[model samples]
Target: MIKFAFCYEHDDTLSFVKNEVQNCLRQREIEISVLCCHNACELAQRAHSGCPDILFCDLEQDDATLRSAIMNVKRANNRLICVSTAASHSAHAEDILLEPLYRMPALNRKHLWRYAALAYEKILDEPASFTYYVRPSYLRVPVHEIRYFASEGRRTHIISADCRDTFYQKLDVVEDLMRHKNCRFMRIHKSYLVNASFIAGFSRDYVLLTTGERLRISKYEYYQMLTNQLKSLKNTKLRYHPSYSEW
Candidate 1:
């Protein structure tokens, strides 16, 4: 079962996205849980309990709710996928929908539900795919593409070597998917959760990724990562590139 939660200010928008998205998903036999939140803190609390798979919101949610919700989501799930209905000043959450409240088309619940299901289907089909729940919807993304997720203040960003595509997802969703896929993602820093496959080499204090991204490797788990990496490669048919040093 794929669970979902939606946090939005307006009742109408909430109804529209959830109805459309969830219904579409049902035909495929996916289960979802939807919640409507009026306060940011309330939503944050939900995230802390266990971040949902997807989080769709009106970025224009009252300043206080927006701020608190953003913070809560980051603390709980940094890779969460967010679909914004308004242009939010919130640094971490990005704008997904193009138009503002009045200018946007009427919220279509059916459409949202179908998209939700389609997204899930994609996840189930991909070997590297994982699932997460938003309040009213569920989301899935490829894990290998993610370099790391970091939080700053109340905002968080999904960092990847391909700066051209900074895919945004609710932090909670990221955590959920991480658990389901059983991938090698580690919360190395308070602000960072990294994919182990990207790691090229490591020492007690830091890790070097093939992408050339240097990540802090805590002394507590550095050796464990080395062991895990070795095991990860044991079953694979690995071949060295010409540039790879022959050890």
Candidate 2:
């Protein structure tokens, strides 16, 4: 069973998103454990003990929760992926509420399908990390933990969460490695190669991230490519088969 945590500050919004997430998983016949916490740090602590897989939240209300939760998970050396009720966000009264990756774009009710896709992708038992050489030992990070890769002069920075690690490498080499693993990343600028799934939305001048940070868009081709890829996520296929009993 996959484990999911929803840390929230409001109730109605939480219910809406949770129900949608549940429906999406039910369609795929995947079993999940749902944990609700108000404070993300506590959520992370419990998640660490349980090796939790996914986190869902309302970004507007849970920024503090999300920040602390991310830190706790990081300190425990675990990965936490959040699904917010922002990809295609809509202003809703307390009466209405709802709910990942590339397809979400803003935290609107209509984007939960893409959210499910991200959740399933994270749960799949595939090779899920990127490895970079670090002298005697290498750093292996789960692909989802990576936010973006930036190349500055002679060094490259692997930025994730709130931390940045620098190493000697070229952006082209990193892009090649991502492609080799079938990881979907897009180059919005010559210096920034971003994970497509983390893309919130974009304007002609900038690409917005779920984290509320903006990166400049240089090449229109990559932006167009990313748009096409996100459109395709709507057709994302989900597969899982349970064993049959031999009597």
- How accurate locally, in lDDT, is each candidate? 0.54, 0.62
lDDT of 2 by residue, 10-115 (tens): 6776676678788877765656888777666667667766745677765555354466555565445444455654433444342122111222456555577556
Q: For each candidate, what TM-score against the reference?
A: 0.41, 0.43
TM-score of 1: 0.41
Q: Say which candidate scores most in TM-score.
A: 2
Clashes, model 2:
11
What number of clashing residue pairs does each candidate have, in the order they appear?
31, 11
- Alpha-carbon error at 157 in model 2, in Å? 34
lDDT of 2 at 57: 61
Q: Write the per-residue lDDT of candidate 1 for residues 123-204, one digit (tens) a residue.
A: 3444465444444554455666667776564445666555322233545444444644434565665556667666666666
How accurate locally is residue 165 in candidate 1, as Cα lDDT from 0 to 100? 28
